[model samples]
Target: MADEKRRPRPAAQYGPTAALVARNVERLRKTRNLTIYSLSAELGKAGRPITPSAIAKIEKMQRQVNVDDLLALAVVFGVSPAALLLPLEDSPRHTAEITGAGAVPADSAWAWASNKRPLKFPPGEQRTAEMEYALASLPPNAREARQHPAGRAIEAAYEDVTRVIVRAAWSVEGDEHEFIDALDQARASLERTLAELGRLAVEHEELVRLRDGVPREGSD
Candidate 1:
């Protein structure tokens, strides 16, 4: 029995998300004018190679994509992993069939997949404690920082600080003037950001109190 040849297992059936991923893979490959052979080569260069035959099987939905393959494909295609899981069409009227969520508006689906919004929230609805908690629970890098002015300010402050540090590290003795200018600019940027954050802190405290049904200070 040990010497006998092993038989191949049947292909596993995948859900709606897998089907969407497969479709996106095919569409992106064709859009970029890459053949299966070339895509396989690109994947190999990415260090997570999928054979040409397996690529065809994936496009045909004959094979399921594992997480590594998903990431490799995203790298080769120059798109975020979420992009490969979203529908190609992004019209608000069109719907994307998510496996667990049923049919969601294409725009909303994309927004949810990109972490820009919660999946269950309706448009124009006021933020609730639950929604706020959900957003807060996400990792810093995954939060929709670009959507809020304060968050963007924080990001700008971080970038300015990083730039100053990099400039300082690469500066020579004669580059003191340039380094000093960069340090001054970064300090100014941080001060502005600090002021913005102070204002936001007050606003955030009020929001938290409101969500928790606590009355404002000096309320009757």
Candidate 2:
């Protein structure tokens, strides 16, 4: 090994955030059951060939990560750049499904339905996972809707209502007694729409609070 490659200095030489990122990198690397040599090889495959000893120094917080190192680490871990930089608990998570479900606290009872990707999962599964992650990154109430500069929330609500209207009309066309069925469908849709609106309200309030740095009612 070259003299420069030797663990150059004590960990205290690096700032606290660098040490935190090092710990997170090590944790994520271990979660994939990768050894230091394997991780270095993976990095090399991604066009940045780092040595195992250097990786050891990184994991041990004996060396600070540069921009290139951070990007390479993100690729090796299969996560976004923010994942490497942010605290684990605050990182964006894949918690939503295709159903446009409500958000759950990341630490709550919700666990990813399929953490273990089968060795030979069909291509569809890969696409589905990617789609789900994209949805999960959005605010839950707006998962299927694109945001506009204005009236985005209204548009989402309109879509929900339109779906309900179509379903309700179909229910009544089948039979005379099916008016009750139409009413039931309408009621269900109304409930779902209300829930979405409630979510939208909360999200809007939170955004306002963040922008103004002011507290709103019942917000902690």
What's model 1's lDDT at 110? 75
Worst 10 residues of 2 by lDDT: 109-118
63-113 in candidate 2: lDDT tens per residue?
Answer: 778999899898889987756654455112332211223443332212232
Estimated TM-score per prediction?
A: 0.60, 0.41
Write model 1 residue lDDT over 53-119, tens digit each, in one string.
9999999999999999999999999999987898887655589998889998886687677655566
**TM-score of model 1 relative to the true fold?**
0.60
After superposition, the stretches of candidate 1 with alpha carbons farther than 4 Å from their true spots are: 1-8, 122-126, 129-137, 141-220
